[model samples]
Target: MGRAPSDSAGGDRLRFLRSFLASPRKVGAVLPTSRRTVDNTLDLAPLEEARWVVELGAGTGVYTRGILERVGSDARVVAFEVDAQLSSILASQLRDPRLSVVSDSAVNVARHLDGAAVDVIVSAVPFTSLPVPERKQILRAARDALGREGIMLVLQYSPLIERELRQTFTYVRRRLSPLNVPPAFLFACQGDPRSPAGER
Candidate 1:
């Protein structure tokens, strides 16, 4: 119905998995993301100059699929999935050489980025579950890694992050997509976030 999810989806590895009952941990897998979240997240930003886009928590390659479609062929997408199963799915799906799937925590965003400044960051992580400091870390990483004119697109289900986002960014714009499963909000922010000319 909605464009069949995305075009650049890596392969047929991602079969529609039904919710399975097991350990508490396994049961949590039932929280699989909706295609609407992915759609809303990627649709928020224009992908023209997204030379290097970092996708945090690229679960099951949903967001990854959308990102690959947006950027140019020469552009690179560095995606991170902290879960083992999701990481494997991401690796299999994004078999193309364009994507680099880091099977680790998104908080290690700085290390994972390898000193490269990203033109944009599209995130699908549920920031509502995290503590304020953790969210701040992620936001700081986004702002710190962005080029002067760069931006960060965070599609969170909570509007509460607005208070925190205002602390770091000069400008913050929010859009709502009620079509999503949980109704997501796209937050875009930008600023002259930079370190001193020669600080080490």
Candidate 2:
């Protein structure tokens, strides 16, 4: 028989804790993201109409499951999880054909896109913990991978990413989810200034 919901949740939390303990900087959080934060993040994303969505740092598939619920049947979600064990767990647990789990870094997101236009990119990455160069590289890659009208939603524990985000995109908006553990700042960014459409 399948595990009870409570048991599943407990397992998820344990997995998250182990992953975080293994690589605090990469995993970012000791617990799974709160439902409120997930709702807030998805509310800002244009997922219903999105053909392709990318999730960065998809720990325990919290945001990934939420994205699947909102996106249409034809929509595809590419989830990047740096933790190998967590990635494997995510792939096995969420057996949806539309979801692709990438056991890799977000910096290589574009390579896996196959030239399809991405409508939304949801990032739960711990940018504050990464090296400056790596952070910038990942941001730049995400910017280039998106379509002209694509939007990138980022969830962070602090506003430190605002400056880097503004440097990459012409538009940036921030919101706060106070109920999340340690709370979180959500950023919606578009209009990559380096892109030709952004220049127009």
Candidate 3:
């Protein structure tokens, strides 16, 4: 049998569940991404050489830890979690100098980056669940914020947005993770994306 959940982890799980209950559409998942999900999604990025990393919908900082482990101490990580309560928990839990937990929408990523050279973008945000406009905005922001060699890693339960990704990104590759709770599709996109007008 597995050990019982620790007090802190149990509390965190409760909070996560509460957030999902409060906003099912926004929260997207009842549980955070599993370790395998995080690893499979981030493997496509060159974390070792990455100087700056950005995370979208960093619900509970699962992928944040993975990025930190792979990168050097000098690297910077900026994570965006729209839910204030979840962001608070993430800030308190991950007290690393290299990490910044921002309580804002993923679309505001560029402003938070403030002209930094971003090397990798890992997104746990449920794009398919979001409003179409919001999804487009976040995708555009990711494309604009990336450095010349930057790569955006998107984890989704479905491949429904592959068309959108292909239009916004110059190249897109996907892989599936059957081990995850709901399973997942990991998209690795690189190069400067075309404008929305060009998408048509």
- Which candidate should be chosen as best, given lDDT against the real structure? 2
Deviation from native of the Cα of residue 56 in model 1, angstroms: 0.6
- TM-score of every prediction relative to native: 0.79, 0.94, 0.91
For model 2, which pairs clash? none
Give the CA lDDT, 0 to 100, for residue 43 in model 2: 95
Ranking by lDDT: 2, 3, 1
lDDT of each: 0.69, 0.88, 0.85
Candidate 3 — which pairs collide? none
Per-prediction tally of clashes: 0, 0, 0
Question: Which residue ranges in model 2 land beyond 4 Å of their true spot?
Answer: 1-7, 196-200
- Highest-TM-score candidate: 2
Residue 163 accuracy (lDDT) in model 1: 81
Task: Give the residue spans of candidate 1 off by over 4 A.
Answer: 1-37, 192-200
Quote the RMSD, in angstroms, for model 1.
5.2
lDDT of 3 by residue, 24-100 (tens): 88888888888888888878888989899999998877787788788887889999999998898888888788889
lDDT of 2 at 145: 85
Per-residue C-alpha lDDT of model 2 across residues 41-136, encoded as one tens digit per residue: 889977889999999999888898888888888888999988889999888888887889999999999889899878999999999988888899
Tell me the lDDT of model 3 at 187. Answer: 96
TM-score (C-alpha) between model 2 and the true structure: 0.94
